[model samples]
Target: MPPPESSGPPLIGPLIAQLRLARRWSQPRLAAELCAVSDVPTLGRHEISRWERQLRVPGDFWLGWLAVVLAVPVALLVEAATRTRSLGTAPAVVGARSRSALLALAQRWLLDPGDPSFAAATGWLPPTGPPTGAGAAPPTGVPALPPTGAGEPPPTGVPALPPTGPVDRSAEVVRLAELRRLDDLSGGAELSGIGFSWLRRVARASSEATPVGRRRLLPVLAETAQLCGWLAADAGAPTDALEAYRFGLRAAGAAGDPALAGHLLGSASHLLASVGDPHGALVLARTGYAGCHTVASPRLRALLLHRIALAAALGGRHQPARCALAAAQRAADRVEEGREPPWLYWVDGPELAAMTGRALVVLRRPRRAVALLGVGQGSGRPRSGAVYGGWLARAYLQLGEVEQACAVADDALLDAVRAGSPRAVTQLTAVRRGLAPHRHRQPVRRHLALVAAAGPYLPRPVTGSRPDPTDRTAPPVGNGGADRPGTPARRGPGGRTGSSVRPVGGRPNGGRAARRTDGRAATHSETG
Candidate 1:
């Protein structure tokens, strides 16, 4: 029977734990209660303890019943078991497949949560501006902005309120959940709007909150706002992104989440650099460095400092850039696996090296950029793949290798499609731009068209110069990202997170409603 066509080894431990956590039950509590209810004497505290810690597997019958109790299919359990066995022999395959499965399973749980109809709806284009049911009176006593000293300027160097008071736990959690949902569903359009809304809401909610909640929710709020600002920039809304980041910086500082604040600042710096404001990016990175020192985790510190280095390089500050890069290397080298924070999950040596390589490219060293980013050239991982493709395209174009540049551009374009991220979209746009000098050539032109066709799904292209009209404003009300294929009157090419195009000029001060080309509401299946 071809050795039962082995699929992979089981990733049973984590799968079981994830399922259990989704149910929100303690191991001992479940053991005692389920043992009595299921009439399985063997399924006692000891067995439950062992299972939770991954020390031992339960018997076959118990396994089947446990799957039911956890609301996980029996087939999934078998798949995990097979993976575990295969992992013992083929570790690489097992690891890759197992990680994919984990992420998939988590996404599923997040989407359905065991009650699909009762979920938060969380359409790709969420209601903008303010949430429903928010109490009236602007959260009485809440400080709108943080207090500022006479000589201390705000992070954005704009006159704004300084952060104060504690974060409201309930309100903050709701806001984060909303932002996270939007992030998962949409690409970039609503990122800034929602982020800005969240900032206003949280700032108001936290006015009279306590110290404990403030500390806990501050980091979350900062991260949320930073993501908003970053996405806004990716959508060709640099100014909006900056405003979002500014608010996020204050929240991060107020909550004492120095590491998180540093990371947000780094993100803001990257946006600044992308929008021909490298000097601004450099300043933001330096500010981030000041905060990075307060973080306890080496991995977090390293990642933040890496951003500083990249920003400085883009800003033409060679000495400080090199110094920051060296510090980042040292900190990264000192970080131990499994000890880093969640945000630093994807920031590894390779990712950092890619950033440094891009910095080299920006500093007019195309050859070095290629060398730095070319590590793990054949790896399928999107993060490294996108960066390598970008650098290669730039390098080949700089060397006047027209054919090679086009080839690399094609690869980068495909990578952007598979990765489905704003960062990838931005990098791939660099590849497209590099090939623009040869735009008349068939291969380059064709590739550019393909990239443009994919535009609706991709993040809006962000140029360091003037914005593209398609990106600067939403399509006419009747047309939007969510238009159906072959729908003549729809007015737009594609849909992202069910977003309908916003009208040009001006709309309502509150969030604009999704509309069609004829200035009417349009609906698609994905909106559900």
Candidate 2:
């Protein structure tokens, strides 16, 4: 890649990026466009990214095409490129020692999250200036791992360690399946580190695997990346989640599987929204659907539509959210069993209900959110129940049923901690924030305290959850803990409702789900 800045009007790269972001286009989408129109499919996101950073300027020939597509005059593009660049605008490049240190620390935390030493990565600061005279190489990352012989295994329980030989496609599939199940049992806080390392190992082994094995492995890589993204989102690490999704996109494109690529796009769209970039999220949602709506399976299309609707809801675009929601319903109804991909098992009735309800809650149609999400109260990931509880709490609060909302908030708090879910924690925070008006009330204060006191999820080995999708035998991660705790008496679906609560007017969502940089979801609503 070229340096981020260079002299003169020929600085075509940042110009491309500025225009693209202005149009809400992802780097991949623009790259795809270039590839489509080019004589030789020579460029991709890497090239587009390079151009934007002024790392390597695109030739004038491509610049003209980009200008036309960007709807900017060639003269304007040239003008922007000619301006002197500031080094401050360039991407931050960490020292190689820092990079190694960060990666090692990340890997260590993932494999052993509960270790108190995780404080290092969370708090460590770089040296203010240059390194000291003696030993200053980022603490010589990973101080004492057995540096194994040529053929021996590295160590037990140490993830991301080099494998002894080539990985087969089947092994990667099995691992992906395992990781997905683990994510369902817990969240990314418990699984991301290991899953990331697993992928790295698979990637390293790819060179040794046969051509046929590599082909099969690519799609698995894509899916694994999505799984990691999901984990990262749940754990409140949106950047890491998005990184995983981007990797998924690249792997999916290389694998030549539109379905997988579409899923990655949709999943990433959701992540973008979760991270508070609703407009960017909306753009990705549209891009995902546009790319695959025609040829994708009905289930896949429905998934994409759900993402679009979710992003719209988060962005407070009620009409668009509503339209997408309706389209998602239609697409969902058209799913064909054998035609849908195995990875889509989570996108069933419960998922549909949750997605719809989430949008509605944001849209301020809380009553409908309660009705739909409550009906499927027993579905989706194990920990989603906590999220459902929080959503229901917000809906109740809207209806002035303060007691019920408090009750629901209390119910979800334990699950939030048990599952280590940042997403759930976010919902709980919003629930508390909304209750500020009723702070004088004892119940509300107690609930607020509960929400505030809830700490990061600590992973305890779970057992007897859903049966492993790939393996016939039951997974060891069971639903025996907080997940199986006696069900709370919810007010929606089978339960009776309070008199103060108003009925939902159809299915409009009303609020923006603001995400903190740390990955917690917050409510950002508008009165449409």
Candidate 3:
């Protein structure tokens, strides 16, 4: 067993304790229940006590049994275990100090790839060819990409394609944009493997291209990296997501697109803020805005500014956050259709309103938050609705509107279930905690029971094997360093817990419902 002192903040332990307590079960009771459910009589009170106390982490056997007895998803327990094991060890510092170092980090992420086993288990397969249109269905029976080793080339018989000119590049970008739209429909958990596969293919193609061709392909690679990073973060693989963002930043720099680089930086900043590193998030957000302020399109500028506003709010810089929010609103107002990059397609009025509302909630201006968040709530995206509505519910709670809070929370919970977003669920968890004092109310009790019933079926974070983090690179910012993923809770101003909102990326048609392969209605998924 690992030393108790080095075990960081005890993710699995707290999670186990929370679940156990939620059911009003003591250590011996939980152990007995586990043994009874799994037909294994060996587990006892001492073992359960050790696991909850962080003296010893549960192994896979116990984890499986615990999931069964506790009525939670096994994947949740698995992720908690992975995070617990990693917490004690210092994260490998893959700082983006230089281009070469960044490339090395990218290579390491490429080598690790996604968890193919999980992908297979979930019955998700990457598309056989590039996405063709908004309604395109991913073809079935495509063989999975073979695993590769360090310094090894891509799988045999899969030769890298030569880079093409503007027309082909545009086609690739359009294809990726379509994929992004698809992601908005299906949650990241479903498409993360596909995103990684696409990134690997594009990275390989870029590597083989001549200098001129590479320049063309580099932008595509950068775009692919952005999408991959966004999906990875949404799926709760923060390490992979960070690596993808860093790789994209390098590619965007090499392609000489400060706007694209800024977008990557802003995306990374959003990831950092979500994982509880507000200081680092603010630094990167400021850096991104600074880098592209002069050249970014109206929509991109708004997106970047919004990132800064959100980061600042999370970090407790009230005045700066307010200023950034105002600037972002102005930028959003000036957006011209068809004038922005394909990647900025999701940044629009409603999205901006949602983000601004989230900032206001963080600032404790619940009344204003309710108004802006209401406008944002009109976006039909299920995941966005779940997330923003959870915040709206919190705002209601702050005003002591228990009935309204519970009603909104009920809708948010339904959306969260439909979207299959872990972040949405986590956000709702916070809202549920906020409603604890009102549990005596009928509405609150109904919502609480609903949430409890839905817990096991909700999607859990899909984590892969940990990456090698030996090298450090200082990303574009001079003094900023890579923020560690999975930090413990951070307290904001006035003793409020720092909360995170989803990254910027507007879904198509304000998250209009899409059709799935089975001809069923498709709901919006988590963006970051």
Candidate 4:
């Protein structure tokens, strides 16, 4: 096997490290976990450390072990290892056709937790948005939920609200509206981690807090699923997010509401694109947008096409990206503010500018990126605002304006910290790494220290890997230093690598996502 140069941590290493940390398992424990699942009599913690440190790949032989132990897609594990290896080597400069194939397999891990066909995506076109309950199918692994008639009723003492009375239904609606407003203020998660756990709690609460017929229940579930999906991705949990989206989709279908279903699927597609699953994102976006086009207002259609453009650009489909972008602009031009959906208030001009700039950056058109991303810098929405600021920093870095990048990075660090976005934090760290040659300078060092204070998993400084003649594919040699992947390995209990490290990331900031300063994909997977 060709060993790629390790200018930075290979894909497998940091992910192994992060996933292991998420499990709160020490290296030895992970090794043991592997052993129990593997045919190999035993694997050693030392080897696991090597894998995390990018010293040696376990090859395809160990993917099943790692996948089962980490509870992630086995294909994803392979993709990580492959990406890291590719980076260590330089791009061979393949054709567009070959490139798209590689891109599809990049971070496009089929996230449906129960989709047996997860890794079997055919040409990256996923199920398009189907009208809910119009022969909508459940994921392969989801056990059929019982009919409400056969389902258990609430206990006698359990709380029950009058079914769909004007006042009772309005109470739930009031709470939902409040949550949305508060979420905007708090940057997505509040009332305890806007994530899978929180979503579950809310779902349970809604189920028990009110008694209603299918009419009321479906919309509630759809809305809950939508928020939960966002939160799950926000907290760096893609699989969980995918599950939430699928459930929300089901609810929308059951409610026979194309508006809700289209919105949910479109948003999910946007998240996928942001997370490096652009093909899946594109497919989902197309599915949802097509259905919504006739029914949704022009502004909403623009938002939908905006997401599609982003995914296409990231996937290296320049023509499609450009076409979609143009279409989105045309749609935007035709917008009628009065006819907007409740959720589309956030999808205005500034957001459009930001998304466009982001797509430009991924396509490596830095000049265009700089202009638009700058406009996006002060977006009031904290999450995308922080990300847009990061993009600004990256655009500056690409133009070789180190000082400007530093200034923007500092601003981004603050916003990202407030937004609790791990990806933005790491993107900022990559800026620092790009400035490694100038680390002797005060601004870089000062900023690095401040970023370090943000959280435990903030990127630690790392020395460059020694060059290897055999691996010629790594990106053009940088300051001879780059941000090495993996948490600093400290010996933890039982002589294992650090397990106390926390996983960090906001939603996969993939579409309209900023690349690291060195022009590498910020990450194909999680950020922190």
Candidate 5:
């Protein structure tokens, strides 16, 4: 293994550390496992330590073995290594701890704009800085915003603002809502950079406005943060999402809008649940619901309850999960058009049905899940369709309906590719793992091939508990939970399956017809 020509801060080292820590493996253990898997005992704990400390770099031989043992793609490892070699003597890439510190500083800035610490925390800010010179090219990997003529709305999805004037709060609110609607068509990966840019603009505006103007702008700031966080999470940038949520929570607090704060908490909870932190998710969901129960609209209440239900199911609190789902449904039934917040325009009956169906699937109630998931698969929304369809396919697999599962998974894979949603891809990845035992079947093999073909369009598999494609004993597909892949499903109370099985389901809906509306009322046609 030849070392790089020039010294640089470790890029691949942190990634390797994260992967090893995620599996709770010590340096010696990882080294031993590498030797065992590759039938080469030349590497020792000292070598592993040197690689992790950036004192040495792993060459092709070690990289291949690491990829095989870590269940990560070789391309990802090579990219990290390549970056280190290219950026000689560059500062270290930000690690998780640094990211968390920056996020905390951002939240604090939102809480107290006059705080001095806020000024120092701007080093690694989002790509929201001033634009480059006219006709100059944008930096690599950052998309250039379209130029707009004077008096025209900004070519960016977010609206433009004057340099010095009283801000038009109502107009800005409407524009923000419009910007959010774009996410339904094009998933967050494409819009996250734009969303962060908008947020930076809003934050600057808030800082410059008068006290009265600042108060009005705070709500807008909170709303923008919420959207940015959602986009970041969808783009597989969980740290960015968390920062946005924390910032939004502070903005919501400053604005005295507990309802919006609750919404932010729920959004954060959803992110937590997606990343395999069910207990933390449940706590946040419950806290959010408790704080704003008196002020939240029926739809908002329903959304919070739905978050709680999903978190509970994922955490294996079956009874509370079911109860929360029932409450969410009742709240949904009571939703009054034109009374709810505009940001929640997407929380219609079908959406709730889909959410409930997702919970039921996690709870291992396949019979009940199929009917609800069938009704809730988002009409004309490819991302939502892919997400719900993935769950529906899982239900079919649970019921021993291989052909049906393959058919549904096929549609889901297409939708996932079309939508370009990492979340949808993650769901489909689980479904693929579940079908591993049935790979001998023609349909399963075809579906697996399709998934492989779509790999370029999809995000890499996440770091935790990824099952080997050839491992027939891989755990059943469920919501990404704490259970490691290939671990046997444990029985819980009443002989119910534990976290190893996806936590999802709801009571049977008795074949209720799905209400097919455009999600929002006619007056809010622009809203999602």
Candidate 6:
């Protein structure tokens, strides 16, 4: 077989070495941490040393793990490595002892207790000096700032993305239609709002133009107004997103697009699950799943079923969730092996795996769940960021790896902030709950304090009693002695529940529904 041609960029080992140095971690420490948290168990310290020495190019799994653990994007790692080669660093230059010194220095800067600044500040430091050699150069092929029209200096840091030209109304209409399909599949409401806002802004801006422009803008403008509802719903503002979807449906009816209207309704049903109304979510999912079967593509129908399964799982109905997931998988399999409609483009092998993983974890097979979803570990798509991290957190928690679970949960929290997703917030809260049992350990206690810090954004459950964040006292860890006469029984999900999972929704569904919303649904109207 012929050798494969290099495509987008080169993967250089020295760059990975340099980044590891920059973080101040020894090869062993990095390897140990990754192995502790990973789904696959093939890695070890010696193997990591080999990769760092350029004896081997670590495959996708290791690369992905590095991306998450280092808290840098995959593209940045690739870019930094190529830039290093352009500067001519030897591939084998970084070694155990040299890396150890760098790690020691980094630890001093980031974690030294003797330094007063370290005591006062969070666990990061300003770069001590300018970057050297290839690392000093600007990232390859990234554009420099264009001169401002008014001679105003360009804003600092990265340049703004180039502006798109006047809206393509037809394309906007098509995209709006596609957004509904995504909503139906994901059961998230923000999809409609995002689509609606994008279209509305375009349509309103274009409406004042000449007759031809107005004609060009009308369809897009109308679609935007309709889309507001779905985006609202997905973002947890169900009532508002619902209104937007209904308005869009009315427009579709007027446009003689029964199929489009059906798709919008289906999307609405998908979002009902996010509001603690799984039965309603299922009703919506089934309605959309069956309705999409007629005018929607097979991919879209499969997506609808997937959302139904997710809702059922979250609602604590295992049977329907399994059935829906199975049907969705079957439908997904029927899509031609290599071909898919544009509307169905987002559904792929990893996404299907992720949805199935979520269901299985809820079904109490977290080990299998991690195995199924771990394929996405290093895929580097931002859209899968939350699910990928959430699955890892869940798996680690289930496996009784408290420290690893906490770290993964931290990753999930950071990803949620980047994605600006409230659902991510709730999921992270569930992870925090899972870590609560270890609150007496210094690191876990520190993590719990951080969880309390997120209270303003992640609002705690209103239905049940919880330890006061202000208490600042550690929970008892280790096996409980013969219980005090009046204390509640210490029940755990699969025996790990004491530390992770909470009573929410006025009851604990064996710790699966760990986030409580005080009987009030998150209305996206507040933030969407």
Q: Global lDDT of each model?
A: 0.49, 0.54, 0.60, 0.52, 0.62, 0.46
**Per-candidate TM-score against the hidden true structure:** 0.49, 0.61, 0.61, 0.53, 0.62, 0.48
What does candidate 2's lDDT look like per residue over 1-528, in tens digits?
Answer: 111111123224435655786688899898777556543264567556544534333333455566667887867754544331221111111111111122222222222223333221112211112111112221111123445566666455333332456676676676676556656655554455556656566655543456676667667766877776666455444445555665565566656666776677677667656546565556566656665566788888878887888777887888878888888888888887877787877677776777788788889998888887676554544467677777878888877899988987787777666654446566676788889899999998888677556542322211211121111221211111211235332121123320111001111111211111222222111100
For residues 1-528, write the lDDT of model 5, one tens digit per residue.
Answer: 111111122256556766786788888899888877655565577656545544334554567667878899877876766553332221111122212222222223323334332222222233231122122233223344565557777654434432344557887787688767878866565566667767777787777777778778888988988998787667655555666776776677677787998898888778767766565566567767766767889999899888888878888989888888888877888889999999998888888887888889899999988998899564888888888888899899999999999999899888877775566776777788899999999999999888878777763211211121111222222222224546454433234343211100111112221121111000100011
What RMSD does model 1 have? 26.7
Question: Which ranges of candidate 3 are over 4 A from the true structure?
Answer: 1-168, 471-528
Name the best candidate (by TM-score).
Answer: 5
State the local distance difference test value for candidate 1.
0.49
Error of 3 at 37 (Å): 69
Model 5 vs. true fold: TM: 0.62
lDDT of 5 at 269: 75
User: Which model, 2 or 5, shows the larger TM-score?
Assistant: 5
Ranking by lDDT: 5, 3, 2, 4, 1, 6
Candidate 4 regions with alpha-carbon error over 4 angstroms: 1-167, 187-212, 436-442, 456-528
TM-score of 6: 0.48
lDDT of 3 at 8: 23
Better of 3 and 6 by lDDT: 3
Give the 10-residue window scoring lowest on summed lDDT in candidate 6.
Answer: 126-135
* Model 4 alpha-carbon miss at residue 484, Å: 43
User: Which candidate do you rate higher for lDDT, 5 or 6?
Assistant: 5
Q: Candidate 6 at 40: error in angstroms? A: 72
What are the candidates' C-alpha RMSDs? 26.7, 20.4, 19.9, 18.0, 18.9, 28.4
Question: Largest lDDT belongs to which candidate?
Answer: 5
Q: Could you give candidate 6's per-residue lDDT for residues 2-90 as a string of tens digits?
A: 10111122234445555666788777777766665553344456555544433233333445566777777866754633332232211
